[model samples]
Target: MYGRMNNNIYILLFCIVFLISIITFTTIRIITDKEREFKKLPNLKAWKYISILIIVAITSFYGVEIYKSATNYGGKLAWFIERLKNERSVKFEHNNIYEFGVEGIFEDINKEHPLPKKLYMASDFDLTFNSDGIITAFDTFVYGKNAHGKEETYLIAYDKKKSQDITIIRNGYANPDYDDDKLVEPLIKTVNAIPVKQTVSKWNESKYGLVYYGKRNWGYNTEGIININEDGKEHNLEKSTSEIIGYTVSIFVPGKEKEVVPARYNLIGDPNWSKANTNPNQKSSKEKQQDLTNSKEQFYLSKEVGYKLNITDKALGSTFYSLSKTIDGGKTWEVINNDPFNGTIGSASGITFLNDKLGFLVAVRPSGTEGELYRTDDGGISFKKVNYTPREVKLDSGQSISPFDSPGMPYEKDGVFNMLVGQGSDGDYNGNSSALYQSKDKGETWEYVKEVKSS
Candidate 1:
């Protein structure tokens, strides 16, 4: 399929080049003819007509390609076109108004907007609030086409306090792509009388909630306070036109303006913020290692000894994990084996140890409906695939089925090791059930127990 698509792209490119060459050739001939005899050429009119047709053909081909790439089979285009037709479309509006409250501000700023015609996604909204928990300013983008039909963003800033009607403080193509490098020092350098908090509004009901940085109590200084000296000249945050400031976001419910809590904050001098400035849009090595350590699957045999499986790499729908042993209560860890499943491709579902010398590891395939079970007896130094005994269970239609799809980690219950092999997402009987297995000789082999139904 992809090869055919690549061939089509090559054909399109050739057609574009051919059409452009004709256009260029005709244009140069028409311009360079000193005696103007080019206009009297026998096929001059015919060539002109052919040039127009070629231009239209090229345009139509480009339009078709753009549509296919943007809509991915016409699923997104209809709704987006409808949004563009609406009068209140956020796409063209320069200013927006909301009620004088937190919920209203949040709803208006974070409301769903039409997919941008040119940009990657919808416009982002930033809100600024005063110390009294009142939203004082906000900024959002309006998109429109230039004379050339190329879309561009109009970044607008508004002030809410100057009037019940929102006041437009600034509007321009100053930061069309919202690139931080284009920021300039504001011309009006007034210290905000009221302490302010700035936050990016939550969009699309994000599960992660609103994102902000800074000290909750420090509050953001509207004027740049931090200063940097370079080349015998001192530049402060405000002087350099740095928008960076520590600010806190407040959480509030409707009709309860007085009941607000400082939910999250980002401070300028905070350790994370400083690291971000040094690294700029990427995690530091230490931070990445810490994240990997935090996500590691661990099985502890005692307070002082444990085993952990850390994901090392993932490629082509397969995840690789590195097994490590930790002594002295996880103070330090040494990698025991890099390939626990011997190059098997899947996700590490669970890892557990029965003793200092016996352990089990479960890996689920990318399909989620199948997995592999492995056992290690030499303290996780090596592992070998273990097979569970499959059992047949009667379905709702009185049909007997054996589901050996997903195998879970082994756990000791009532002095016996029990494991559950699940049917995963492909189960049609008992709503994707599991088959329980038991091991009496410490996870070396398994015996069929019974089918467990999904709750």
Candidate 2:
């Protein structure tokens, strides 16, 4: 029945077009013959009305042809015009992983960092934080096909302290029905840039914004960003779908979550993966991908592009894992540093940030038999110990994994373990899982406080 109906529609359209083509050709031939044959006068004397109809028909065909010709000409003209009119857009010269992670945006620090002019943050698939501090905005993944399904990822954020949901984008992990053995592709889908609820205590100042990275569906990373603003996310389990994946940054207007950017001006990042979590290796399974991570190296997200930069198995004996960045307002992104982690960090369950330029990323480095907290001073270029903090976080050897991993190993080591330095009413960052901190002389010393918090 369906096939017959489709065939009927095709036949009807074909007949109408065929008839039009034949009539137009025949009329042109008749007009040409008349003109050649001693001025037949187009049979005007016999029927002026007929001649008029012929004129209308001929003109209509000619009109369409002329319009098509003009359209093509205009397109050609446009191509040349653009070449002449626009100067090359300002080019952001590429830099290395160390260059990308440098601390240069700290010129604007003041005694009291005023209410943020703008803010944004992204987290992993399963959320760990309750949206505290500058971890400004996020949305809970509502299951049951409303937007996100069982393996769906939802991106939520706010410009300010309001309930407005500035959805960036969403994507599914993998299809259970396919049995592809593919663990979600590691691109934007793999690393959930979803911010943990906890933040760092005080000590330093620098540029600020969220760091979001993704893995899994590398091609459809743009679709994730699209999901942030629109309703009805993509569902592979069901049929019929539309989506685009990529990354962008937004200025959360004071007192509002409204995204205020010039239309079509999505400040997209390096055109590597579609979105951050787009898995480059869809053909491989989850276990195979994990098997590759056992070896270690130091990974860095430079503006660099090449086979060497894109895929890194290890760095410094530590697997260079995933990393995130918030260049635009929308989707979170993976640092081109796209390798495993340089060291073991997943055991340290929390993350915090001050800004884009300078922030502290804390993680657990297994010291002998136990895990110790390590701090990254400049994003991840190099890490150091917290001034007064202990060398390592000792854990019981009987436990198979570190403390944070006991919670189902939700977060990956490299990007997940982090901390921030901020001040509260009491003024001190006193090693609280979540709280405010104070530094008397610009990070040379510090203290922690539980009163007011710093995000």
Candidate 3:
């Protein structure tokens, strides 16, 4: 960027120099030409001298101002060029982003950024809030798949003043696609991250912790010159061409943690697909046959999905909300009003485990006019509609420009499901602002709340 600016300066200077040279040469030539004719009218010499003086003065002033501004711009441009070049040399290889703790007030990221951005999943992670309800940290989860088909898990972190300093906690490569089945889809294959408690402590115990750093002005909050290694490239996290990653999702349910990942999402063809293998569509046989086989044998099961006892409410799209049930360590998702809710709660933008019982899902309403949030009571199988927008909105990425319609949901409390929702068919659905909405009675209603934002 700096180099580009420098080139512009040079171009401007060249134009100025060219014009000045032409004028100076033209003025001298005119004087010489006039001299030939002036012998007949000598009084014109005074006019000639006056014209020469005026031209010299004007060009000299122009040259001075141009030189000063150009030199100043050139120096600044040099500094920026140096910084950018250095950034490239020590890029994504550095992973010491967490060195800077929470440093300033968590600003509204939606003001400038496109929600659900490609760099990270827009509104799926939990917001780490301070004791005062102010957001202190930001986080999201994501599934990383390499070209060789090795899947890896990661936790991306954000904080006020230094949100991009992510920390990679638990990482492990996944099994090979023995079937070479790129087309196989799963019932639940992704995860939604929820933030719990976070440390506001400083790096190196050096008085530079979030508490140590005064609020607002964050000049001293140096997370350090960490390299922005995105997708193996040394680039700035803010302006990288990396894929959007929110939270690390796994069908790896807490209770079903021990179960191995199956080959396909649907056991449809698998004879074990029906615990009531005799007839899954039959109502009487469903009750008559006590299928003792693993639930995986009957239907699609994934650690990536939130489980419940019974689900009635649903969201639109390709998911089946009533299919999975998570009983042991997680929340109970017993849902009601299935007739009112249609569609599945699978592969949506954000999903969070609020405590062990309450949960949030960002999905489209049946009418599809606005985005909505769904709540689970027992675990899975049913859901209740909450007055929440479905996804985040964004107007533009440049100049921090955003329209009212572009309200977005970007981040949330740790471990809590956060999402962005608003009106319109956004150019990039993820870029819309996903600022959060708060509801007390299980999303029956909602109210204004702090929005997730960047530094």
C-alpha lDDT score of every prediction, in listed order: 0.50, 0.29, 0.33
lDDT of 1 by residue, 1-455 (tens): 22246547988789799889979987887778835755478657898899899889988977776666444123245334433433231221222212232234323433543223332101233454433344555544344444576654333334554444332211122113332211211100111111122221322111112212111112123232332221212233333222233333333232322333223322222232222223325655644443223221566677668888765654223457789998865656889999998887556767888789998888766444677899999999999999766677676789876776678878999989998888754566666777889989888889988777777
lDDT of 2 by residue, 26-122 (tens): 6887777855644656654677787698889977975675455443123333333433432121111211111221111111111122112221111
Ranked candidates (TM-score, high to low): 1, 3, 2
Cα lDDT of model 3 by residue, 1-455, tens digit: 22345657987889799899989986787688976644656777798899899899978976675555444223344334433432211111222213211212111322322122112121133333333334444443333344555443333344556443333322311111222111111111110011111222211122111111000111111121112111222211233222111112121112332343211111222222212223334434433222211121121123323333222221111123333344422223333334323553222323444444555555432222334455666543456655433333343563332322322332345533334445433323334334455555544555556554432
Lowest lDDT block of 10, candidate 3 = 211-220
Error of 2 at 337 (Å): 5.2
Q: How many backbone clashes does candidate 1 have?
A: 8
List candidate 3 stretches off by more than 4 Å. 1-320, 328-340, 343-347, 365-370, 388-419, 422-431, 440-444, 450-455
Model 1 TM:
0.38
lDDT of 1: 0.50
Candidate 2 deviant stretches above 4 angstroms? 1-326, 329-348, 365-380, 389-438, 441-444, 448-455
The CA-based lDDT of model 2 is what?
0.29
RMSD of 2: 28.6
User: Where's the lowest-lDDT run of ten residues in candidate 1?
Assistant: 185-194
Per-model TM against the reference: 0.38, 0.22, 0.25
